[model samples]
Target: MTVALSLGATANLGHAQNTLNVATWGGAYGQSQEAAIFEPFAKETGVSIDTVTYDGRLAKLKTMLNDDGTVVDVIDVSADALNTLCKQGLLETIDASALGAGPDGSAAKEDFLPGALSPCGVASVAWSTAIAFDRKAFPKGAPTAISALLDTAGFPGIRALPNNARYSLELALLADGVPPENVYRELATPEGADRAFAALDKITGAVRLWNKAQQAITWLVEDDVVMAASYSGRLFRAAAGDRNIDILWDGQIYDFDAWAIPKSSDNKKDALRFIRFATVPARLADQAELTAYGPMRKSAFPLVGKHPVINVEMLEFLSTAPQNFQKALKFDAAWWRGNGAALQKRFAAWRARVNAARTDREAARKAKEAAEKEADKAAP
Candidate 1:
């Protein structure tokens, strides 16, 4: 039921608006980007930057392109989404040679990290999905390892997990003792996936599902859930503020977020100019000053200093930092994109089965209690 998109096709950018509509993430991430990238680009270029918030859903982008083809001028898409969009020809090609040179006068290509450059877009930042747990939940001890995620007895508490299978399956495998680097390779096989599901089965009744990134952190703070899988930046924001939570970087899944021009943009020229300006070493490092995401440019690494508000070192929290990258898993977007449809069907069926079983158990328990009550009445 999956179709491959035509890679070489192009879309038209309709009539121009006075301002460029740039679609991006919201929350602390958005605020950081506004300070580091958007505001600066707008101030210097004299072109108004009109922001549009989105959940990074491709279907929505597809619909916008199909409807008018000029609603959103630019976008901030993840590596996986960018790959699909590039194939669909929904994005304008970015000329790497035209990008601004690094502060050291190095060419953009040489300065960017490996896999950071693509025809789809220029990667802006590297972020991670790390486990953030409530500090007070574990009275016995803290869970410093990935294996503790599924060890319900060792770390007994309700959990919050994303409803999607991508991270869930991978984390389950890691908890089941799969070697860090071999996780994707192992997941590529039938037995590996089965092992992952079996691992998930061990903690069935204790999980609360979340559909959005915000839901994970919200549940951790407001609900009875003890721990959650969430974006590291969100966790950092929560921890930096009032949330009694700390990050567990073990088994972190790392990936990139990129700046891309939607082919439907009426202002491709302006979007490109903004992209070039925003990706400069100084601008990228400025983002790191505010959030936990690591700038995509290698030169930006050293320029990252302390968080201006908190006055703490920012490098340690970055997904690229040596200490954090040791056991980190690079998210295999290609694998997920390829197998997504089939696995989504399988995941839906599995969820149905799990729910049905839980419902049946509840019914049986209630029936047994009713019979015991009648027996006590008859005996009296």
Candidate 2:
């Protein structure tokens, strides 16, 4: 019996005869998918999700591809990586029409966030990096504006930031008083670069850089720093564990992460079925209930529920929420794609210099202490 699926009908996949492997970021985001999609889908369709985790590194996927294709069936990738992979023919072309319709009978193509449904991939979440702080650190008051990141005197403390120059430069410019709309324009020039570097220099000595989102969260948990620029997903996860981390959505840099099928996927049938099952409107909404990442489907927005453990409404924490999202700056991946190499080299040099200066300062302080102790002994 060939069941017909129309534009209005939702897809309900049958039991999977074989296992389907999924690749995703294994953190709060992965746990959300586990609760919302993978576990439920496995029970419903009998397709156990053999999930693997990876940081968003494009080269890893390329290197993993073999004669038959990639070892994984479906992948969760960033929008930027999706574009790069699709252009390189590293991914399989998915029929966008195969996606399930929304609960309100809206077409799959229409229910999804604009530009989210693509020929090669489908967007899962829209996440962002926001200025996060420990509420306990600010005994006087919490910062409500983006400029608080640069005001060392008003909120005196060390800050943690991601090692990426792209976000650092953007936030530096934002804190330096460049208006949101004009940020990219200003950052495109030499003086703007100097201004941004100077803005960062205001707290360069006080900044503790982190390589992972979790590292920044750890610092906050330990009270090693007052604030950090961190991912919404990591913050939400930390908050769920009873950490007092709070985020100011002001000046957040947001972007999308999509799911793509590698060209080498041997189990394309089960993979396609899994994709459809995972992206159903209810599943998308369910995932959002568990994490701070915004579902890429507009239909999922109204269906978003409260956190199962924390019991707070999820919408308020989302990057796409009306109040929080209004002040956000959409991360310009295309712009970065064009200018990243040069800017990255420049940032590397600056970091090298900063590290060297810190080393020299530490050495000088130790030498001064030893000299003072020797002088005290002679006087005695």
Q: Give the number of the best model, judged by TM-score.
A: 2
Candidate with top lDDT is: 2
Tell me the tens digit of each residue's lDDT in model 1 across 229-321: 988888787766654687888888889989899877878887888889889988988998898798888788888898999987788778766
Model 1 stretches astray by more than 4 angstroms: 1-21, 26-28, 52-55, 63-73, 104-106, 136-141, 152-156, 179-181, 211-219, 222-225, 242-244, 263-270, 306-313, 332-334, 341-380
- Candidate 1 backbone collisions, by pair: none
Off by over 4 Å in 2: 1-19, 25-31, 46-48, 52-56, 68-72, 95-97, 137-140, 179-182, 241-244, 266-270, 310-312, 332-338, 348-380
User: TM-score per candidate, in order?
Assistant: 0.74, 0.76
Q: What lDDT score goes with residue 38 in model 1?
A: 72
Lowest lDDT block of 10, candidate 2: 1-10
